[model samples]
Target: MEPALDDIWREVHLDGLKPVLPLFPTDALSEQSDESELLPDYAESDMNSAISALSGRHCVKLENLSISFGSVHKQPSWTMDPTALLDVLRQNPSLKTVTLRLPIPAVTVIEELGDLSRLERLEMRWWKDPGDTGTTGDGTTSMELFPSLRNIRSGKLSTFRRILSYMSTHLITWLKITVSSFSETQELFNMIQPCSALKSIHIMPIVPLAPTISDPLDLTLSFQPILKCKAMENFFIHTLNTVPPSDSDLTSLAVAWPKLSTFTWSSLSRYGPQATLEGLKTLSANCRSLRKLDIPIQVPPELPKQTPHAPFCDGVTVDIRQWRVDDAVDIDRFVGYLAPLAPRDGTPWLRLGNVKAGVWIAVGDRLRQCYD
Candidate 1:
């Protein structure tokens, strides 16, 4: 015998009663029933209705919500209605974090999003075509709309610049920008300056559109503005196809970022070992606040029989040594040289060195303890 819809609704509405409500009509409530459930085809109107239904539902106050739009479904025409969504959010002040991966135009929605005063964290990716500037209705660029945004991950330099400009006027605490072309590098440095609260920056390299013949010295000057940001404590730069500048260039960087505590450089060798080592020395000298260092140290085919005397400065305690040597003999000799340099206080020291069979491992465990 099948249950009547009104009877089922009465049972569900009973106080303290919890029922397994199915979206589809079912004739039987028997466990393991084979009837296929049918869900109403979702539509724009259905979504709007659901939002309306949940508006006053006090239980709907969400701390975090993630929305992912499917690529197959035709985007609802009303999905572009940011004003309506903003009003709903304004009504529900408890919403704290929102992550959206949808097709709605970012710039249009961002302007409406500024009203989310209670929002603490937001992640937005602008994948839509930033419409032609010549278009009559496009009021402002996407950057202007997201002035209050503290974090962003974008695919284009133009978009990054727009966001950077906004942050300069307002204030941003953290920023991440990925560049697809080397030509965009200078513009990135120039734009990053205004973010006074910026604490960390990560640069992932893109292939150069065309190689420029700027002198290595000029390359150092180009990066000075980025190092000038006072709030930056951690910095990382990685390049794909482009050859890295010389040690002199890195020295210039160390000089510029005197307050840097953590620094990482991942770049292919375009210069010789001497230059690389010289750059590292300069970095060590300039970055007095440095506590962590991750730099590639290239080993030459033949190393000097005697280890070089690289004296440690006063008041320095922690030392982490990472070697990129390829040969076992060179690694052995390098470790032998560094063992004595380890601070006697036994602070944490990390070493990545090549051993037999070309495997790299940390052989500094005992040495680290000895320093402690």
Candidate 2:
């Protein structure tokens, strides 16, 4: 009976182990074992030293490298030696993307940057006072640093133009410029003409005229050069606390941009609804390529209550919208007049009311939903 019991136990153990035995290395049992063995301390140190050497030699293959400056309460500064950094960049030829946030001198920044050959994308944020000296010791502005850069996002228009002028020989596919004031619109427009490959342009705070209240009629009329850039397909302008142009001005723009597909205006309240609608009429007449249109309306209280008619657009789809504050309850009735202008599919025409503090939160929310 004891032999029978031992046989049964042996059978059960063999049955369980058989399923896992094939997973073990068959060579381990066949190969002759070596008598020499490594000590754990030496093995670990050797492994660590080998890893360090390999890492030092092949560090350039990393996909993402971020260089950040600035602390909680202090403005950012790039304190590295520009010449040494340039040398490191030249050695790390595999780097494809670069993000720079620093306070280095613009001349040094540009000089070191011109050496990166494989770089495809670049994002840089540097501050310069308007009164600072303009040229490097080599007579090159900060713009010569990046000849291959394609996309640019900047807080100051002057810096953007400076970069654009340097890269005028290269064709940029996308450009976005944001400025707090409209004082540099002419200069910005002048620099934009040479970029013939520009497909999309967004001009925020479009100042048709400077913001000096002293000259209420101080509108500047020097956008003809930009209007002639036939390559422009998408144009967006956002104006806050600035006057809107007259009907003639809109008419001129429409005739100038015959290829424009998307045109948008935000926070435009310099004129009454009559002037706005008249300007829209002019745009529809001239811009035969317009497909998407956004216009914010600020109707005056004294204007006679009347229906808004569909503005004329020749064979092109258009979306005309009015945005007003909640307190302006009288504007709701005017919605009916503008309802006819809504796209037959219920998309082109949008009516938004009850804006808060000149920020069209409700309109923005709805717009986001439509795009989503």
Output the lDDT of residue 76, model 1: 31
For residues 266-314, what per-residue lDDT tens digits would candidate 1 score against the true structure?
5553533233445656766777776666665544455445444453333
Q: Pick the candidate with the highest TM-score.
A: 1
User: Could you tell me how far off, in angstroms, the CA of residue 325 lies in candidate 1 after the best superposition?
Assistant: 5.1
Over 4 Å off, model 2: 1-66, 70-74, 77-88, 92-97, 117-121, 128-147, 204-211, 215-222, 239-241, 267-275, 281-291, 298-322, 327-329, 351-372
Per-residue CA lDDT of candidate 2, range 1-372, in tens? 222211111100001112121111123222432212111112311323322222343234433333434432344432433443344445455555655544445444454556665555555545443444432122134445454566565545645544544544235656667655554555566666656766677776423444455533223355555665666778776655444555666677677677777776554544443336567666766676777666554344554454545644534443434454453244333443344444444444453444544345434443444334
Return the lDDT, model 1, position 205: 49
Clash count (model 1, backbone only)? 4
Candidate 1 residue pairs in backbone clash: 345-371, 345-372, 346-371, 346-372
lDDT, residue 102, model 1: 49
Q: In the order shown, what is each candidate's alpha-carbon RMSD?
A: 10.2, 16.2
